[model samples]
Target: MVDAVARLLRRGLPVTLAAVDPVLLELRGVLARAVDPGDEASRIAALDGTLRGLLARFPDARYAAAARALFGLPPATPGMNLTARRALAAERAGHEVHHFRKRVEPRLIATLTAELLADADRFTHAPLIAPRLAPVSARQPVLADPFAWEVAEQEEQLSLLWSAIYAARAELLAVERLISLRAERTDIVRAAVTAAWRWAGARAEAISYTTAFAPDLTIDELVALAGWTPPLTPGQTSRLTEAAAGGVAREQFVAHLHGETVLDDTWTTGLLAALQSTEPTSPEQPGAGGSSTAVPADPDQNG
Candidate 1:
């Protein structure tokens, strides 16, 4: 009987009518039997199995819609099974005896509805489903109800909408992270550039101090004026000494002193040389002894 009903449903009978009619007839027949009380249990189990099989096979939007309609039927408190009776007896004296209507049946229906809806959406939108299956036009109408198909399509649309929302959110987060990284790099570069500039200026002044017989100069004063840290490593110190001795200009010397890692050594060296070579005062006497200090006009003004 279960197999017969399943075959009919697969052949596309209206599910509600097909399920209810046969089940009612079977129950009526079981009740009419006078000899065996246990016969009713077998009949009820068969009906229950049939209902479950139907739900399992047609877990889709159309089936769910049909099931939802079925749930609206007048509530019928069928005779309790032995298991239900035992469970009710085991309940504590003050506790309520849980019934199908109060505790389990409604929840079961709701769960079935939800599962059907979810499965319907999953099958409809699945990329693997539509392309591999025969086109609706070529297949017999027996398996292809447009109303059922539309519910599945709507589920697919919802899936696509959620995917789009998630994709957009992911893109926005990526863009935000990119912007933050760019800002951090920019700040680091700016600090590096400023440090390089000041180091170059100080080195130029240091070279002047060493070469000229001017007032004694402190390393602290040189660093403060130049706005840079002196190279601490021996390799860097050697490089600066070599460049200074090679007649590298004040700007170049300053850049070299600032350290190669912080600045572009070649460009900084070139800039320093340009500044030093174009000085208005002679290199032989930057400030002469006991005489009025001669101030060279601003290099920008001269330019």
Candidate 2:
């Protein structure tokens, strides 16, 4: 039976290899740990130390050279970062789940059913002649025991069949879930991309405003470039649109539209006073013309 299973797997080697390899490696590690935890730890530590030494010795080695330097070592590819490793592990797990559901589990069920059927056949066709009967009075008797055995075998086979069916159903459900998770993961990546683009654009806009520089394109152009369309009504546009027919300046617009001040006037006044005290102000300054005189700089600089 094991040989038959081996042949079956060999025929489907390409399909099964990826699904089985990780599982086998993990199982081997577990068994090794169980057999000698200290030995396993030492082995791992030695391998890690060897790889580190090789990396230090050949910091610039590429491909084949790198592989040769770290020969007999486990994977050390930096590209397989923790997150990538986790994703790969999840993919492997899903594949293994699929393989077990499709191949291994079905074989086990079939084997059990076949064995039960053979047992039932043997029980139902057993010889029932009595050895103690005299030659002339010999009687061929029915085998009640065989019938009982056949009934037991039938029940066992039914149970096995149900178990196999249940297992297949479970595997199907799990595969469906795995597919759904993959789709969800894709959606998450897309959402993250969109958010990143929006953040970058907003940051760029803020920097442009702070620098008092006109952007290469207008806000409307930016919106168009970003593939967005305004959904605001006329009233909403009046409230937010700086150049709308009934729009006010940004500060006043925010205050009136939101029914609250855009900023704390007290805080603004205090900050402006602080800034004024730190620097000399000209009497001809527009907003500062009626304000208090600023401090004068050192006379040494007037030379």
Candidate 3:
């Protein structure tokens, strides 16, 4: 499987990731299961997209450079010859050609293969959760509508949750778009995207915490969630909360995004505060949990 994967990756481009050679059949099967089974083009595109996504998230710069040198992918000169590629890889990996060829190259490919397989599995599987039922009285028809009522015990206000998320994410998307701009630095682009994903993690955590109990809630349960295994820090729930009120984290992060010029954070904080202020008086559903789980308010509001 490893040899087949290596050969297939050597081919690199989506157009060639097919089973023309008998050796690629195993890898093709894996790709088929992970993406659209019918369309060859779609499957190949999915594989390429997954590979790019995996490379982008790699923490170490050396791994990224090695991948580029090994495969003629983005940020790498696809037309480079073999000696040139190895020389580039050696330079980036900080090793002589022999040591890199002997040690680093093999381990790097193995890790890449493992990550690709895991991405396939993630696409194919989802955890199943049992649905909680509503109370008998809660199901009774309203006075105006004799036959209308919801059956689910909990109601996550998806629209409102989505509205706030969309509003906040709009700015992040603008910043990500800056990657295409000639003036933007790669590090700045990375910072913008990381903050965006952290916001997404925050949303997932909020939904999980608020719904884990239709009865009540606690902080300990939330802490038990993200382990060291996930890319995010386990203790980010508090810091995630701080981003709402123009917290220093968001302020500094946004400042960096603006290329070291610190600007007002009301663009985000005001938007978040506006969302939370609309919260219902009583405990609301998950997703857009009661205002307590909201992205924090503007620092001015606190004073």
Candidate 4:
């Protein structure tokens, strides 16, 4: 499902992410029932049934969109096996769960939706989630009213489908939260980057620090001046670092060391070098100097 969605995004399809919210909310409810400690046998039976129904619906829900996008046709016949369907749903759900507290990329949700829609043809040819191979003659004798029985069966399947969705609700919500945070983080970074660029533009040579009575600022300190946390990726960190380091000469990267204490120039140099390096600096690097002082920024400055 993840791969499919990525492919769709790459294809530039305008898939909607709103379709997933309801699916996730339903999954969360399913999980809630499982977490409850009552009626063990009934719970197991219901869970099994619900999962089976969802295994069908999961692919059906996305197939229409995928088929429409890929072939300009309606949804094709379902063909994926039950196990494959379940695996796809669970795997995608688990990914969102993993990113619950982390910053997710803003484009990820849309990309996932597109990929799922793109795989309509494959899913159409897949086996049923709950295939029926029982003898048709023997099964016919059990029902009093075939039409009523079929209607009831359909209702039950619908119920089970919803149950399956509720089961993974928590994970879906987590993914949603992560995606939201990612957008927020992007905005924050944009503002910070703009500020850094402006600061560098106005400065001549390098931005001096008030280390006269204070200590030298470290790379980590510079990051802090940007006003964010460790949620940033290596690429983002590097971009921020580059923005802050702009216009400053390598020799004057850590300028203005004026404390009574002896400043370790190597520590400052190493940190600046790491920040300026083309490759990302390792987290274990000495750039986050433990004894490094803070670089005071202007009252109105963003960096």
Please report how far candidate 3 places residue 218 from its true position, in Å: 16
For model 3, what is the error of residue 100's alpha carbon versus the real structure, in angstroms, after optimal superposition? 1.9
Report clash pairs, candidate 3.
Answer: 245-297
Q: Write the per-residue lDDT of candidate 4 for residues 35-141, one digit (tens) a residue.
A: 44244443444433443333333344433233232311122224443233333333433444234213232233344344334333333432222222235565344
lDDT of 3 at 48: 60
Candidate 1 lDDT, 213-250, residue by residue in tens: 22454433433322223334545544544555444454
- Winner by lDDT between candidate 4 and candidate 1: 1
Off by over 4 Å in 2: 1-77, 81-221, 226-230, 243-251, 259-303
Overall lDDT per candidate, in order of appearance: 0.37, 0.32, 0.46, 0.33
The TM-score measured for candidate 3 stands at 0.46
Q: Judged by TM-score, which candidate is best?
A: 3
Q: Estimate each model's TM-score.
A: 0.19, 0.17, 0.46, 0.17
Task: Give the local distance difference test score of model 2.
Answer: 0.32
lDDT of 4 at 45: 42
lDDT of 1: 0.37
Error of 1 at 178 (Å): 18
Q: What is the model-wide C-alpha lDDT for candidate 3?
A: 0.46
By descending lDDT, how would the candidates be arranged?
3, 1, 4, 2
Tell me the spans in candidate 3 whose CA falls farther than 4 Å from its real position. 18-35, 128-303
Better of 1 and 3 by lDDT: 3
**Candidate 2 structure quality by residue, lDDT tens digits, 50-146:** 3233333332223223222122212423334333333332343343534544553344324423442343343344221111212556655445798
Q: Pick by lDDT: which candidate is best? A: 3
